[model samples]
Target: MSAPFRDEEFESAWRELDEPQLEGGWQLFTEAMGVTIYRRYDEETGLYEYKVLGVLTSCAPARCADVYMDLEYRKGWDKYAKELYEKDFSGRSAIYWEVKYPFPLSNRDYVYVRERRDLEVDGRKIWVILARSSPETPWDEKKGVVRVTDYRQSVAMESNGACGTKVSMNYFDNPGGLIPSWLVNWAAQTGVPAFLTDMQKACDAYGDYQLRK
Candidate 1:
């Protein structure tokens, strides 16, 4: 995953996004709080991961992006995050991010490149952002954390003509430790939906949390 943005990995991801789900083969993991979750096996590469699609009725595309890239905002909603920040940026959009997990689990982090683009389809502007984990920056030890390299996530949002956004995310991560498969499955199924709920709530308050000039 050391490749830079727009490289082969990203190119492939862009194409896959056109189809996002693996068609009728993708199993429905859960659907709640307006977020419909799906899962599939990818044992050849990483563990079981989720592909989530839903609508955030309270936010616009810009607000969604703002909440995602703003690390401080995450602290207010992302409960699993013990520590989160971006540093040692690769140019302007790619950077290193560290995440400290909670107790009983090894902390894992990521290096992701943020790619954004706007598409015009049928006279409508659609915005998409993909923040994918890149290994271009070498992994370094953080006293009590385990480095997680196998992580990928992307978001595509299009306005729904009512100020809301239709969003989708393809995310997967491999926690490098002795954790059981069942536990990993449980965490993904439970954590992702909760994350989305918190995200939607945070997005509702984005304007209030805007940084002052």
Candidate 2:
């Protein structure tokens, strides 16, 4: 069970973010906390894919990238995470995450692979992390939880030059179940911004956390 994505795939995703015409099909969904979210209808899944762009006023790009990759630190900040861990799949490591939904809804879990890249395009530094759901995992589905089968997310970050980081993210997923469309859309519009705010808080405290470690 090697990684399903290649380095070229991540590079291509990052390049797409840099393209000026990439926003053509996406419609503005919401704006909050310096982030603007856009959504586009996915014909294949009848779901919406989100594109988020913002400037995080909390930390530098490098620090922000480091915070994102630190699983131990994530456990403390991400309140919605019920179960999160990583295990080796063949020679590659993959993540297992179970997210807590509202009381009446069943929790959703995901098995995914992620990779991070540090790149410099024309002297501007960029940090990119790409993740996608994988079917090759040793875990089995739990009775009380629903497994998310089609999930993909990519984030690109660079310095904003005022001690902040500029971030661009593309996210899509289908939480398998009979959830209403409006509820799904509402969650994306709100949850994504809240997650960014939490991430900034985590980034702001990462230095202290590392010192203690």
Report how far residue 197 has shifted in candidate 2, in Å: 0.7
lDDT minimum window of 10 residues, candidate 2: 15-24
Q: Candidate 2 — which residues are off by over 4 angstroms? A: 2-4, 20-24
lDDT of 1: 0.69
lDDT of each: 0.69, 0.85
lDDT of 2 at 187: 79
Q: What is the lDDT of residue 176 in candidate 2?
A: 79
Clashing pairs in 2: none
**What TM-score does model 1 achieve against the real structure?**
0.82
Per-residue lDDT of 1-213 in model 2, one digit per residue for the tens? 534667786676666456623555888888887788888889988878888888889689999999999987899999988889998866778899999988788999999888888998899888999998887677788999999978999888888778999888888999978887677866777888889889999999998999999
The RMSD of every model to the true structure, in order and in angstroms, is 3.2, 1.7
Considering only N, C-alpha and C atoms within 3 Å, which residue pairs clash in candidate 1?
Answer: none
